[model samples]
Target: MTDWQPSALQLERIAYRQRRARRSTLIAVVSSVVLLVLVAIGIGSTPGWPRVRATFFDPQRAWEALPVVAEGLWLNIRVMLICAVLIVVIGMALAILRTLRGPIFFPLRVFAAAYTDVFRGLPLLLVIFLLGFGVPALRLQGVPNAAVIWGGAALVLTYSSYVAEVFRAGIESVHPSQRAAARSLGLSYRQTLRFVVLPQAVRRVMPPLLNDFVSLQKDSGLIAVLGVIDAIRAAQLETAIDFNFTPYVVAGLLFVALTIPLTRLTDYVARRQGWYGGGGGPV
Candidate 1:
């Protein structure tokens, strides 16, 4: 048979759709440009704009601070990567403990529940301060009293609590029928979780997991308060020299740059997993 071709009406419909899409794209681009131009004009016309620009948007200071801030950002990258792994592993373990059945597992469930509640309720900054300062003050032998160690521990503890809840939600979302089916197939509970349930649960929660990591990536900057010499601390030092806020802007931009990719990946995964609609719908 010869290749099929669209009829006149079908061809007309196809052409109309293409034209509509192009028009929509053009309108979107024009609207965005006009809005941006208006915003720039408004800001530029402000009475204090010149002074504000000199203080916060100094190109020279930004250029000079770029190398230092970027180097400091590398520390954040290393810490975040290390903490992310620990968060996932600990979170998964906590989730599993919380989900375990039977009276024998009651104490584990209680412990997991209490841990999540306590950590989730407490402010992360407070946790960081407590761990970084309080822990060091105790000064037990063989314990690392460094702020970096305790601050990183604070991050892992707080983030793992939240991440554990996410994992637990994913685990509970896996239907009981799945567990029953696994049991019928002669798989033990652990085997079922390992081979069947966790795979699907983890897949379902991949988007949320990435979202957590994105937040973790940003929060890694908080360690600067503990004097970890990360991007924020570097920016603070630069600010002290001239009180110009350019280094802060630069550091913030770097974080946004890093987080944007993970944020986009999360959206992509959400769309793929049918948790989003028509490219991206509210989830």
Candidate 2:
């Protein structure tokens, strides 16, 4: 009876806490909105804002640029999809090469290491420039001179280097016991890798792989510099005509929109895999 009587006070306290939590959430939201508004007001009051607004935030210009920019974005989407496939394949192959054991495989291991080191160390823009410009300059017979192809190849080379390391890390992270168990079950090294080790390794590194793919999506825009006429180039053309920077903003927004979903997916995978910390954290 006494325990039942105590319940009224506890229930009231619980209700009060719930009310406070709701109020706090509302206050935080309002405060954020207020802060943003104040910042916008301050920026608007600046002397340069009128010109800046006309140039960079022009709604009419943005609307006009949308269709052309959208058309160019399709090229980017195509190139990114192609490069993503190539990167994963090349990266996985290099990773497997690096993981090979024995003196017979020494050259392969060295080559894989060198490939990753050189590409990973070089700036991606430089790689894109070299491949996009230099390849066409060579004028090799049977080689496609399309800037999109060359640019996509460059992205594959650079990103494969990075993704190779991720795959290698995943391969290495597979427990030695698991490999031993596979061997004990009469599986050959390749068979064990195919059937047991790689599957597990891939699962472990999926989040990192997704993260690299997101980066690839953004880097696809760099192809615009090669005269591929992707979103950025389209925006540039519009900007040149109208002398308004709003088209560039629109292109940027499109890229951001494309990237946000992938980034969220990466975070979701990381959380599910329990990869919550920086540098050498558990997966």
Among the numbered candidates, top TM-score falls to 1
What's each prediction's TM-score? 0.97, 0.90
The digit string of per-residue lDDT tens for model 2 on 1-283 reads 3454647889899999999999999999999999999999999999999999999999988999999999989999999998899898999999999999999999999999999999999998899899989988998999999988888889999999999999999999999999999999999998999999899999999998998999899889999888989999999998999688999999999999999988888888887888886555431
Worst 10 residues of 1 by lDDT: 274-283
Choose the strongest candidate by lDDT. Answer: 1
Q: Which regions in candidate 1 have their CA more than 4 angstroms from the true location? A: 279-283
- Looking at model 1, residue 95 earns an lDDT score of 99
On residues 116-153, what C-alpha lDDT tens digit does candidate 1 reach at each position?
99999999999999899898898799999877888889
201 Cα displacement, candidate 2 (Å): 1.5
In model 2, the runs with Cα more than 4 Å from the true position are: 1-24, 277-283
How does model 1 score by TM-score? 0.97
